[model samples]
Every structure is written in C-alpha cells, then in structure tokens.
Target: MRSGTDVAYDDVNELIATATRLMQKDAAPDTLTPDDVRKIGEELDIPARYVDQALEALARRREEQAREAQVQERHARLRRVRLRRSAWVGAAVLGLLAVSGLVVRNGLTSTLSDVARQRAQVRNVVERRESLRARQDTLTPGLSRDAELSGADNRVAIEQRRYDERAADYNASAASFPTGWVVRLTGLPHVLPLSSEVSTW
Candidate 1:
C-alpha cells in the first residue's frame, strides 16, 4: 500500500519532462532503435523495465486528471443550481410576508371602522337625549310652595314630571346601547314610547 509519504515522493514535473522527450524521439519518422531506449534509461538512472512502468503510470495519471477536472466542473454546475433555488425560496418567503402584512393592515382598518361607527351611534343617542330633555323641561312648570298648596292638579303635575324624568333616563340608555355588541351579549326589548295621559296625584 502506498502511504502519503510514498505518494508525495515522485517528482511529477521531472517524470513528465522525461516522458515527453522519450515520446518525441520514438515518434520520429525513423524507426525506434534499442540504443535510444538504452541511452534514455541510463540518463534518467532508471531500469528499462521501470521506464516502461513510468510511461504507463503517466498515461493513467493523465486520464485521472481529465476525470477529476470533469468532476469539478459538474460540482460547479450543481452549486449554481442550488444558489438559484435558494434565491427563489428567499423571494417566495418575502412575498408571503408582504401578503401577511397586507392582511394584518386590512384587519386593523376594519376594526377601526367598526369603532368609529359605534362612537357615532353613541353620539347620536346623546344628542337625541339632549333634545328630548329640552322639550320635557318646557312641559314641567316650576311651583312655589303657595302654588303647591293651592291646587290638586299641581300635585298631579309634579308626579307626572317625576315619571317623565325616569322614562327619559331609560330611553337614553336604550338608545345609546351598542346595537351590534349589545344584541349579541344581552337579550332585551326596545324602549316603549312615553304616555301622554295626565297623572292623578
């Protein structure tokens, strides 16, 4: 078995130079002579049998180098494919994030719109209460102690005033209740209209 030390021992550059000279000489138009091989073997200080082995080893090495270069080129192509696939994956992730962000923004906008509608409805109820109270005030007459003592109708008027005031408070609460949330959260009847019948004190 060739250890790392044995593998590194051969001077590849010198061997290649020697092989090139031998090939050029043999390939001349003239026929190879035994003297040529003898001279090369003596000059390189190698046996004739070892020289033949070296030539075969050189051919095998050249073939291995070609195969290694092909493998390296294939690895480079695979790396490029992987890089392109990664870029596409990154883009897909970014697109998904953008879509998710838009969805969240739309949800927030809808929530804000719902809140605004509820606020507007509550404000409308408050304004209506104010108007109703103003009207009720005109109907209620202020009574001094002398007027209170003077008539039974005045006592009836005072009792009627209390009823209207209580009814107005309920009407205000019913009108201002948030229709969407309240209907789902609690089951309740609508406020009935006020009565115009005179009260008997």
Candidate 2:
C-alpha cells in the first residue's frame, strides 16, 4: 500500500513528465482546452483540479520562456548591428588617413621639385657669370670696359640680384608656419646666401 506522501510524490512526477511530453509535442497553449486537462488527469490518475492548475502554470512558464527567447534574439541582432557600424567607422577612418597621407606626399614632392628647378636656374646664372669673367680676362683691359661688355655685366648683375631676392623670399615663406611644417617634414635644404661678389657687381 502506498503512503499518502508517496502517492503525492508520484502524482507530482506524473504531472511534470506529462507536461514535458505535451510541450515536446508542440502543444499550443490556446489549444489546450479543459477537456485536454481532464484527459491528462485521467491518464495520470491525478485529480482534474490539480491537472487544470498544472496546465495553467505550464502555459505561463512556456509564455515566459517565449518572451525570454525573443528578448535574447533582439539583443543578438543589436550586437551584430553595433559590430557592423564599428567596422564601417574603422574603414572610414583608415581611408581618410590614407588620402591625407597621399596629399601630404604629393605636396612635398611638388614643392621640392620647384625648389630644385629654381636652384638649377641660380647655378646656370652663376656659371654664365663665371664664363663671362674668363672671357673678360682674355681681352685687353680697354676691351673689358667696352659698352657691350659693360652692358652684359650690368645685365648679369641685375639677374643675380633678382635671383637672390627670389631665393630669399622662397626661404622666408618655407620657414614660416604651415609651409614650414612641410619643409621640415620633407627635410628640404635651406637656400644659401648670394655670393658677396654678385652684390658688388
């Protein structure tokens, strides 16, 4: 003979097992009528009132589980969106940096090229003046003072002065703020002072 406690325990186990089987069968909560509860109670040999209460409790538990699953799914979707946004932001930042680097590189290259061309012009002028001096030395002293020679000397002097002024202006601009940063970063050489002889001429 089963004691009252054993009988109650058996009834509770039967209720849990039957509820689990119904849930596994995908029983819809709304479809579980009072007749279904009565049938479960008869099968489990438990009272209809207890079965009805258990069915209601099980339905609430299933609803709560469904709500929790939805919440978890929403959180997962939110995390994926955040991760995608982060990736886009990171790519944008890198692209900006790459473009900025290219701009800086191109600017520095152009500036240096201009400076080199200017320096070549200055060298050519200096060489021309040296060639003229050598020719003057080969001539008689009177011929050196001829109108043509004097005019050539004057023109060379004017050209040398103009070159010096231009060079000085360029150096000043490069040494100033903004441009100076580019100059320093590129390691550009500073313009040299004009020869003292050019000033006297």
Candidate 3:
C-alpha cells in the first residue's frame, strides 16, 4: 500500500538495524528464521513476498560459496603434484651431470699419464745413446778401427732414432685431435686409448 521508494528506504533501515544487533551478539546465520525476516519486512512497510525472495538469494549465495571452496581444494592438490614431479626431474638431471663430469675427469687423467710415460721412455733412449757415444770415444785410440764399441754405438743410435720417430708421431696425433672431441668421445670406457699407446712404429 505504501510508495515503492518509501518501502525500499524503510526496508534498508530495518535490515541495517537487524544486522547491527546480530553483529553485537555474534549470532550465527542458522539462528536467523523466516519469522524474523517477516517481522523486519512488516516494520519496513515491505511486502512479505520480498522477504522470502531475499532468503532464497542468500541460500543461492551459500551454494555458490561451497562450489568455490571445492574448486580451490582441487587446484591446491594439482599444484602439489606438479611441484613433486619437478623436484624429481631436477634430481635426475643433477645425477646425470655428476656422472658425466666424473667420466671426463678420468679420461683426462689417463691421457696425461700415457703422455708422461712416453716422455720418460724417450729420456731413457737418449741417455743410453749418450752413454754409448762416451764409451766409443774412450775406446777409439786403444781399440782397432772395426771395434765392437763402434757397432754398439750404431745400434744405440738406431734405438734413439726409433724413439724419436714415435715421439714425433704422438705429437702429430695429439695435434690433429681437438680438445673438445677428445674429452667427449674418449670419456667412454670402451673407446680405444690415444694413438700413441697402441703403436711402437
């Protein structure tokens, strides 16, 4: 029977007053009844039907809230699964890198060792040649021209030349191979050792 605007303003005032009283008491929504809504509507000059509509709207809002909470729970579970998978993948990658590093380190150490051994053999050959030359010089005046020491000196020189050739070949092969490929391919256990290790000639 009242004007729409007057009814609306009165309804708003009544709703505000009820809300303030409920807040002071910390009243739960379950305690709110249709009779309480109807009483507020009557005081506001509002129709009883509108009060029922407001209660239905509140119920729909509660249902929407429940659906949103369920969605958030599913999203949190999916995030946890993705994080665990990423952690495992990261660990596997780190392990592979560590194993590769060890293989490369061992290969370099072995190659350097072989080179050291070859150098030592070359030094031995040189020392033997020098010793033979000294003996030949000491015996030149006392022994005949066709002395056994002269023949021994020739054999020592030949041995020295053979060692020299091997050293030269080793140096050449090392030069031909690039450092990157050497590390990558030679890191494997089955791959043959450097060229110098297998051949004497």
Candidate 4:
C-alpha cells in the first residue's frame, strides 16, 4: 500500500495532468464541471471524496478570479471618467483666464486713448495762448489799451483755466483704482498745471 504523502502527491499530479490536457483542448477553466472532475479522478484512480474536494477548490478559485477581474474593470472605468472630468475642468479654467485677459487688455487700451486725447487738447490750448500773446506784442502801443483786446485776453485766460481744470480732473480720474493700473503700466507722468498769468497787450 502507498504512504499517505505518496497518494496525495500522485493525486495532485493527476489533477495537474488533467487540467493541462483540458487546456490543450481549449477548455476554459471557469467552464469546468464536477462531472469533468469526476471523470478525471476516475481515470487517475483517485477517490471520489478527493475528487469532490478538488472540484470545490477549483470552483472557488474560478469565482474569486472572476470577482477580482470585475473589480479591476470597474476601477479602470472609474479612473477614465475621473480623467475626462479633470480635463474638462482644466479647459474651462483656461478659457476663463483667456477671456479675462482680453477684457483687461481692452480696458487698458481705452484708458490710454482717453489720456492721450486729453493731453492733446491741453497742448492745443497752450499753443493757441502763445500765438495770441505773440500777435498782441506786434500790435501798436495805442491799440494795446483797446477794450476789445482786453476782453479777448480775459476770454483766453478763462479758456486756459478751463482746459487746465479739465486736465487736472482727467489726471485725478486716471490715478484712481482700475484705471490707475493702466497709468502705472504706461508710465504716464503727471500733467502740469497751466500758467495762471494772462497775456496782455
């Protein structure tokens, strides 16, 4: 009679050989039946009880493997969904940033344009005042006392004052929040106050 260890070893060998043959025949392990185990056991001269245990063990292993595969597949699907969601979120954030940059650029351009226009007006007023003074200097000394000339000088002074005030007001507005950022970025200098002296003949 064979020792218990020898019998167990022989049974394990028979099981391995039977499984190998089934694999060579393209039999799926998950599709193995108790009848197939019994047939293998009978052919190998293994006990019926042992054959039943081996069948149960094989079924349990197959079920565990199936469950594991399902869990892995579920994890892979969830990971793909999360990656897609993250990509969408990133794209939305980038779009928002691009829109915000365009809005800021437009605002800065508008502010700078207004500042340039105001400066040009102020320069024109100064040039006109200078021209008037030079014309008065060329007039006859007797004509210098004329009331019409005096009134014209006064009007020019008032207009100069008005232009200066407007320039000051624009500067103040540019120095305020939001618009001030544009001023700093463009390196705009402060607008000087116009001379208070009126041109007289």
The top-ranked prediction according to lDDT is 2
Model 4, 6-32: lDDT tens per residue? 556658888789889888788556565
Q: Could you tell me the lDDT of residue 118 within candidate 3? A: 60
Cα lDDT tens digits, model 3, 1-201, are 446644566588887898899897885465757898899899999999998898899999999999999999989999999999999999998887667556655655555565556656655665665676676676646566345556656664565455555545444444444434445555432233333464431
Question: What ordering of candidates by TM-score runs from best to worst?
Answer: 4, 3, 2, 1
User: For residues 1-201, what per-residue lDDT tens digits would candidate 1 score against the true structure?
Assistant: 355645334687876788899999888857445557657897988788876776678779999999999999999999999999999999999897667555544543444444344444444544554565566566656565335334434444444455555555445544552432332234433442333442211
Please state every model's RMSD to the true fold in angstroms.
18.1, 10.5, 11.4, 11.0
Better of 3 and 4 by TM-score: 4
Which 10-residue window in model 1 sums to the lowest lDDT?
192-201
Q: Model 2 off-target regions past 4 Å?
A: 1-34, 139-201
Report lDDT (Cα) of residue 77, candidate 1: 96
Q: Which consecutive 10 residues in model 2 have the weakest lDDT in total?
A: 192-201
| lDDT head-to-head 1 vs 3, winner | 3
- Residue 42 displacement in candidate 3 (angstroms): 3.8
TM-score for each predicted model, relative to the true structure: 0.45, 0.50, 0.51, 0.53
Q: lDDT per prediction?
A: 0.57, 0.69, 0.64, 0.67
Q: Which of candidates 1 and 2 is the stronger one according to lDDT?
A: 2
